[model samples]
Target: MRDLNVCIIAFSSTSQSVNLYKILKNKKYNVVMIQTPCTISAGCARSIELKEKDLDAVVNEIKQNNLEIKGIYRRVLNDSTRRYYYSEIDI
Candidate 1:
């Protein structure tokens, strides 16, 4: 598969992850819950994608709702292998 670099939002609890998805979806954010990729160590089996520009807003929302998140991640591509790699984001 080709490299798919993306910013993903992860949670510690599956229910909380899905709940955030519903909230973001209702707000019309380009978010989707998917099976957690092994590249990133998270607290749940499910994860969601969030836009970079929306990071601050999403963070606020998450905090306002008292949701605990594992962290954000950036999916990077290994040029030599042309495979995807995951890197943890401080935010």
Candidate 2:
């Protein structure tokens, strides 16, 4: 199978994460609430997950609303090794 690439939006606070989840859900975006990965230290335990293809739109939504975020990341899951790799996304 092909690798899966996901976009992770880390928030400074749990409330911010949940608020963004709500906003995205209401806007009909496919998103999920997730625990922040240990590799990312800037955010709280809660974060938001979405498809990599939606990253730009999500980022735009965040900016248009002036929501604060700790950082953004691209997570890739290797199907063969069953390992996940993370990289910070510049925004």
Top lDDT model: 2
- Candidate 2 per-residue lDDT over residues 1-91, each given as its tens digit: 3436788888888888888898999999999898888888644999898999998999999988889999888887768888787778898
| Best candidate (score: TM-score) | 2
Q: Report the C-alpha lDDT of model 1 over 16-76, residue by residue, as the tens digit.
A: 8988888888988887788888767634899998666777888888888888888888777
User: What's the TM-score of each model vs. the native?
Assistant: 0.84, 0.85
Off by over 4 Å in 2: 1-3, 78-81
Backbone clashes in model 2, listed as residue pairs: none
Deviation (Å) of 76 in candidate 2: 2.1
Q: Which stretches of candidate 1 lie over 4 Å from their true place?
A: 1-5
The TM-score between candidate 1 and the true structure equals: 0.84
Which lDDT value does model 2 have at 56?
90
The C-alpha RMSD in Å for every predicted model, in order, reads: 2.7, 2.3
